[model samples]
Target: MGQRTFAEWLERDMINAYIMSPDSALSPLFLVERQKLESMLLGEQIKNIITCEEVDRKERHEKLEKWIRRLEMTGFEKVPLSYNGRIEATNLLQRYSHKYKFKEEHDCLLVCWSDRPLFSVSAWKFRR
Candidate 1:
């Protein structure tokens, strides 16, 4: 659904929410890394498709705080991430390259490559 419509629903009193999004500030780095990884691990056709998708996402992406503001404006408050969830996420990442890591900030969990944030996961609940 469109963001406007989603916000309208939240304003009308939707309950718990979770969002997973690409971190726009670091998207350029992610796109480059993704392209390199794809080129190495996948075929040429898949790599080309991923490149196109990354270009489109890069054009459309917005900063993480923009979303926080949008949700907060609609009466949604940030929810603290769970310790178990964080532990699970960390364990999951260990199955891959060690360059991947997570950082918790502003009540959100960010997945990063080295030091650059690539994606964010956050939870929210309507303020009673």
Candidate 2:
């Protein structure tokens, strides 16, 4: 991301997939923008994205096996984070920020658990 915009990166097919934390912010344009950046990709028009909100449920434990299978099939990435925002993400965030030259809240803004990928975060230490 040194000289590339988010949309430009997608346009050039530099990133195949990315891991995102639901705890971070997100927006619908994150995915929809892909179509805009890469006009060539729009021809196929296949839905390759899956959101956690679509699968979240209270009674899914009864179907644990199927749920696990579906989740595995979807290849969702698990990001660890704390509610207090005190988790140690130096190594993780630093690498991305340095590569992307992200500054201030924009770095934080790039990771979250929103619907459309405003940003991404991960919790590696523990879970709440």
Candidate 3:
């Protein structure tokens, strides 16, 4: 599949921090390796950066839902790596208003997607 991986596309966005949840635990050695990769992409060594976030399962769950809602607000319907812009999928990164948040500090806004349909973004689903 000659397509850009998420990390590849992410590099173009140049987001300040890419938040890896505490749930995705990695060994110290592996974590170091990942930090190295991140530093390479960022062009700086962000040493002493906090690796783990202190959040309860409940809060993590809540935050995840909130992000999904925002993503749905973006009006993108295709999956990120394969989205073609007419298939009725959802994307959340588009900012219609003049104001948007761009993090320069070690903070990132995290989002995830599943098998939701296009035209689902920027709208709601109601079921009984």
Candidate 4:
């Protein structure tokens, strides 16, 4: 099978197998991770399966919150409560608060990490 076809099959198998024996196959941490991943996947699937714009908006917001929490817990400092918008992320850097900057450019939030930017967050993208 093609790579995309195999990936689809694998994702389906992961969900099906987890459903069939969640307790047996998944450790507590793995279960939590799986739940997060499943929530993200199911939200995307909902966007594809249903056409309601409201549902899509809610799902996207929920997903963004999930990601933000995940990032914070992984040591990405949370910006001050007074700050908002895309630049808020860069504003959270304690040491580089003055030099490092972020801007909304090219339809994306650009974070400039200078040579001396604070590197507080771990390299790992996800936590167990």
* Candidates' C-alpha lDDT: 0.64, 0.37, 0.37, 0.47
The residue pairs found clashing in candidate 4 are: none
Global CA lDDT computed for model 2: 0.37
On TM-score, the leading prediction is 1
lDDT of 1 by residue, 37-106 (tens): 6544543333243345754433323468888988999999998888998998898887666777998777
**Model 3, range 5-74, lDDT digits (tens) per residue?**
7755554333234423222356989887876676575432222122224542122222434656565577
| Ranked candidates (lDDT, high to low) | 1, 4, 2, 3
Per-residue lDDT of candidate 4, residues 1-128 (tens digit): 54566656655654554343322344889877877777577645544433447544553323334656666687764432223543456557545445465543322343444442212322233333
lDDT of 2 by residue, 9-105 (tens): 5534422333222222347677557535544453222122221235452222223335434544666433434434532444465554533322223
Residue 81 CA displacement from its true place in model 4, Å:
60
- Could you arrange the candidates by TM-score from highest to lowest? 1, 3, 4, 2
| Best-performing candidate as measured by lDDT | 1
Cα-based lDDT at residue 118, candidate 1: 72
Off by over 4 Å in 4: 1-24, 52-128
As for lDDT, the candidate ahead, 3 or 4, is 4
Model 3 misplacement above 4 A = 1-16, 19-22, 44-110, 113-128
The candidate 3 region of ten consecutive residues with least summed lDDT is: 112-121
Backbone clashes for every candidate come to 0, 17, 12, 0
